[model samples]
Target: MVDKGGSDTVFRTEERFRQALPDPASMAGWTPRSANAEIEEAPEPAANCGPDADWYCARIARGEANFEAVGEEAQFDLTAFADRSAAQDACRKEKTWSAKYTEAQVPPVPGVDSHAYYRNAGGLDGLNLFMCTGTVVAQVLLEGEGSSLDPATAHSLAQLFASRIHKAAAAQ
Candidate 1:
């Protein structure tokens, strides 16, 4: 049995501690003959074979217990990307020119017709993948468009983008 949230379900029965919680997909993966043979041999009948209130409560308790023990597996910080307003201004100016330059360099991807947009995003772990990708592309434009911002600021921005990608991948 498993919870509606797809967590392992807990059951108390005559087998009690002897029966390890069964994962549905994994159990299903086992030879059907094996599982059916075990079922036929059991002294007690199965209860709550599907997700139910009891299963949900048990799963929540288990997850909360694990969470209390280990904490979230990933973290993202965007504060390091802040306080670069001058760099941002330079980026915006460069973007204006870069758009014209890129438009001139490549016509358009076949069967694709749309203008690209540049946006600045700010936040901590609330940031998403789209924001991270845009920041990296923006960094490239800043460098190529002759921005006056120092290399250190550019490097910091790149680090922020890289860290965001790492955190997202870890979370997944």
Candidate 2:
């Protein structure tokens, strides 16, 4: 998880995070699976996370423990969570990139705390990136027909998204 190290400047609204979303147009031919980019909520804490987690993800992130963990293997810890935060924490660990993907060279993204790149580890088909800037963590996955997204493309996309996050962060 790419969380802010000691900063509290979390992107709590989609509008704020929207400024940091990568423009899909930057990738040639490949189109977004959804018309809009999505936001991921922070790791759920048993105690309310200061101000109720990132509002951007709060609205869209499903609030139930019944959600399935999408990956090569089924997740055992998904069910029976006490609340949304517990479920989200468990779910994040079982996610495809976390559970079934292998690490590759992370692209050089400027002005960010840290970042990582991942590719399908087994039967999966996608390239994933998890990055942090300030108090926000962005999880990016690019998948398409036939073969998974190429490294060159993933690198370019990572840079694109990072630049957006960097720009918005600078303005703040």
Best by lDDT: 2
Error of 2 at 62 (Å): 11
Query: Residue 101 error for model 2, in Å?
Result: 3.6
What is candidate 1's local distance difference test score?
Answer: 0.22
lDDT of 1 by residue, 22-118 (tens): 2233232222211110111222111222222221111111100000002111111111111122222323333444354222121112111212222
Q: Each model's RMSD to truth, in Å?
A: 23.2, 9.7
Q: List the residue pairs that clash in candidate 2.
A: 44-85
Error of 2 at 11 (Å): 1.5
What TM-score does each of the candidates earn? 0.19, 0.52
Model 2 clash tally? 1
